[model samples]
Target: MTQALRFRLATPQDAVAIIACVRAVRGEHYPIRLLYAPEELAQAIAYARLVFALALLPSTGEVAGLAALEPSPYGRTGEMGVMMVLPTHRRRHVADDLRLLLVAWARQHGRRGLWGEVLAPVADSPDAACVSQRFTENAQLVPSGIALGLWPGPGGERQSFVRYARPLPAKASSKACRLPTRHRALVSEILGRLNCPVSFTADSPASGAGILDAKHEEGLRSWVLAVPRIGSDSAAELAGAIRRIQTHPDVAYAHLELPLAQPGASALCELAEARGFFFSTVTAEPFHDGPGLRLQWLAQPIEPNGLLLLNPLARRIAGHQSREQERVRPWAVAAAA
Candidate 1:
């Protein structure tokens, strides 16, 4: 029996089905926990700010898959979240269809880009090869970082994530943002290779800039630092923030998001690199409209050589990370001493 698939924006009525789908995919090896409760999900859907899409069988209205464009904290980007297809629907192009639907929704909503993170297998594993091939078609995947203890297995397991981005076509009047001098070479290299448009603006740093917000996720042992602007005093502010983050018990990773348009961005980025931060991804501006650089610092060691990198850009970033870590190791050790 052939069934027609219908894709539509989810309403509050679809919350139960969406939650069920999420729980079903999670099963025994739940890689991540759902951040929203069913009631919360329903409320959020009713609010109509974040867009969730449901793939259903028209005959019985059975939800076959689900995807969502979650609003970023900074309001300029939408993260592709809760992408799942039923086990029975696997390898049937449902995922691709869902991805397209999500992208279209993001574009309709004026998102600069759509970002997603996929769990990848370890290097040399048979599953790694298969998964790599799966992402090879029409996906720009970048190797992110080792998410320690992110998955559940026999005891527990960690998974490496591959981050991918898809930029939407901007308005004709939108001007390109300036690329920082220190990161220009690498960023240019990345832009040259990827099919995404990442524009930056070079402008004077906003006055009285400092850390605007910070959030810590206990589950991931990660801290996200948001900086509205990076000015001359950013170094002192960031140093204090990093010191606090490092001192946090069981902290594994810290991420900083800074506006790419701000003046002194390159200088601040250089300072961050000296303090062990490395480029992770380019995301939409958090505070205003533009692109921002997402940099990460890991307190724990990462075995990049053991990661399964499907994209060339991912591999290059991983290599750069390894080299940067090595270059900063001695300084970190001596500083601690």
Candidate 2:
């Protein structure tokens, strides 16, 4: 059954075929707006900015499966998202082939880790997104955390994502992470699963200049404020940024990423949590210079109880995050109102 297809890295010529395969599998709800743009997508593929391993039906040269390998800004990690196979190709090893091909390409390109976000189900079909979870688990990737309400729909409705992770040999970092004991326990559990070495610091270092970068998602009306270095003024800078961002009535939310392995990350993190940001997840990949401790501040409130997670680990995360969300729920509600 698997021998019926040919798998290889995609080129600009595969732009039409990839788009068609995505449409055949998901129609217009594919959510990746890049698929709708032919020229830019082709350019992205040509430049290697958007790399894909494609499964093609040699008889007709039609794309049967698609898997992407998106490298992060830090270049230490590659995101493995949506090894999608058309419905007609189900029960075959088409997805497995595409997944393996993408993994091989990532290794050849020096990607140390493949810890990425798996988009949670949308409001319409909450369980439909589990296909990726099945694949992630099959690849021996451990499910660590959930970025609750991370993805946004065209109608302003937001969805969540599971943190799927599998770190390669080169990705193991022996860095010491500083955090409160409460967060430290879960993070420790997750890190143990990834086999990443870690030691805990007794206290968060005080006083440095906040070194960070802020990027916005115009389409999703969200922001990712990444703090690589925590300075004495980081909390202030973040507060000012949050105030400015929230002033935009249509802006959905803001995500703050702190370098967990860095010394004052927890101190700055504590301050952010006080300012209405709540736990999202400890990112599987390295962000800034190390693993990111991510927190989110939403302009709207989402019912955490409503999450429909089938996997045991996912359900466990839902429970943990439900409590985390509760701590900051009042602040989010007041801001939204």
Candidate 3:
């Protein structure tokens, strides 16, 4: 028997159904102990602001899945979230259709890159398997690398996560920067300012960035950046962060915010440039509960993929668009000394 399905953009009115679908899927595929409340869902929708939609079965007008695309300050980059299909709609190409639709929407908006995280089963059991393999395979995406272990919660206690990527067809004109492990200390310090609670510092030259886990070490989510000593608010602190980057032979990198509202932020950026660092890519908080800012370089370099979480959705979206090699915004290179 042939089946019929329909898809459309989701609105604020559909928030309840979207939440239900996500919660149901999480119960089976992920360990989301703290689910979002109704107000939280509203806030997430507000933050995402650009293409948020739900999949609907035309025959019955039932909500089948939820997907969204969000803006990243980085040029031509956007993040994908809430890609979920209801329990009843799994294994039916519903996700494939929704992902393709979201990609088309992103390409139309001039966004060439997309990113999302997939969870891996921490323990060897059928209960913790990664469920979105089919979505990545159908899109013909390439695995930039694995995230290894990134999960929320106490140190040594977080679950494992995976990073996936797909280069957009339209990004042929775009070039990404690649940095080595030596710059991890420098990048860590800059990103630390925007995302605290998880800070990094270089302990020894050979060790690179020595990740301090307030809890345990193994199995915890380690923040990998070129520079160390993130989250400083003083000139001396910034100086130290720069020194670390300068001394390290690795590529320099850091994620900085616009620095408009803060005091002395521009001065710090100025100091960074003098010390041989520049602006690379913009990175915002992963969730609504985090800070928003760009990852500025102090003395490190930029990664080849342009982001920590390589976006598979970006390429998938690029495949559905007609535009090829269109430029959006130029990379934020540091001013010359």
Candidate 4:
């Protein structure tokens, strides 16, 4: 008998069911680690910044799938995670239905876009294909040398992730921001593909009190740093933070998010580059206050040729990433020498 599928916000009672669904679907490729414990799941359900949803088989009263939408560093952007569907329901399009439900929820909440990072060993992997069919590929993130303990692959190997985005129905006006002169053209092209407007501003010294927050994801061996403010001493503060980040024994990748609204943003970006960070993308507002820019520094190498990009812009960005790496190779070599 065909069972009717229903979707709704997940409650505390649904935590166990959601965990089971995740284990059933992802256990083989990426075993459930500490991230989705019942307590954590419950908290995620109750967290104001996160939306958790479950797909239920009404007739059988079984939770067939689960997904969550968590606020991004960008205020108008949300990241979709905890996406899982049971093996028995694989052919039922339960994943798609859950995603659509999540998208609707995000739109109702005034989100400009939604994105997801999926474990894609190859471009055509089933997981990557699903993301391509549902979302536009934004960029590929290389693994930060350290194993992602939470997302273990076959034989428990860590897998790199690919970023995909789905923009909702929201109009974004053209806005000017400072960008690196060397890669301005490529960055402009990427922003155009994303329907974002850009006007480069002249670089200026960052002044004011900048706040820096750092969180280490032990499961991913990754460090995420958020700078919500830029002050006169911001450059020194940022440099200190990066130095500390480099000292972490297990660090794989470090991400720095800077607000675009900051007058000294362009200059700060230049400072970051000198410290080995590379341009990633311009995210929406970092906070409820305004938009932001994202940059990354990798402690190891990433093979770009293996990326499966579904969008032309994504491909272009990948190409640029390769070129940028080459452009920086000499400097890196000299610094090492």
Query: How much does each candidate deviate from the true structure in C-alpha RMSD?
Result: 4.0, 3.8, 14.7, 4.6
Tens digit of per-residue lDDT, candidate 4, span 1-337: 6677788987767777777776677662343343358887677666645677788888776788877788764467787776777777777877777878888887787776566665445565666354543333233321111111224346644565555555324447766666668756765554454555466777667766878888777666678788777778888888888877766667766777887656777777777777666655555444555556667666664555466655455556666666665665554333333
**Tens digit per residue, CA lDDT, model 3, 1-337:** 4346678876656667666676667653333321245565566566555466677767766667877776653345566655777776777877767878888877787665466656534334364253464556566544322332245433433333343444544312211212223333333332332222222222211212221111111222122222222233345545665454435443222333332113333444454445544333323232222222223332212122222222453222222110111110122222222
Ranking under lDDT, best-scoring first?
2, 1, 4, 3
In terms of lDDT, the poorest run of 10 residues in model 2 is: 283-292
**What lDDT score is found at residue 42 in candidate 1?**
81
lDDT tens readout by residue for model 2, 208-277: 5767789776655778888777777787787788778767787777888788777778787777776677
Among residues 3 or more apart in sequence or in different chains, the pairs in candidate 2 whose N, CA or C atoms overlap within 3 Å are 208-231, 208-232, 209-231, 210-231
Candidate 3 Cα lDDT to native: 0.42
Please list the C-alpha lDDT of all candidates, in the order they appear.
0.64, 0.74, 0.42, 0.63
Model 2 lDDT vs. the true structure?
Answer: 0.74
Clashes of each: 5, 4, 36, 9
Candidate 1: global Cα-lDDT?
Answer: 0.64
Q: Against the true structure, candidate 4 has what lDDT?
A: 0.63
Model 3 reaches what TM-score against the true structure?
Answer: 0.47
The candidate that wins on TM-score is 4
Name the weakest run of 10 consecutive residues (lDDT summed) in model 3.
320-329
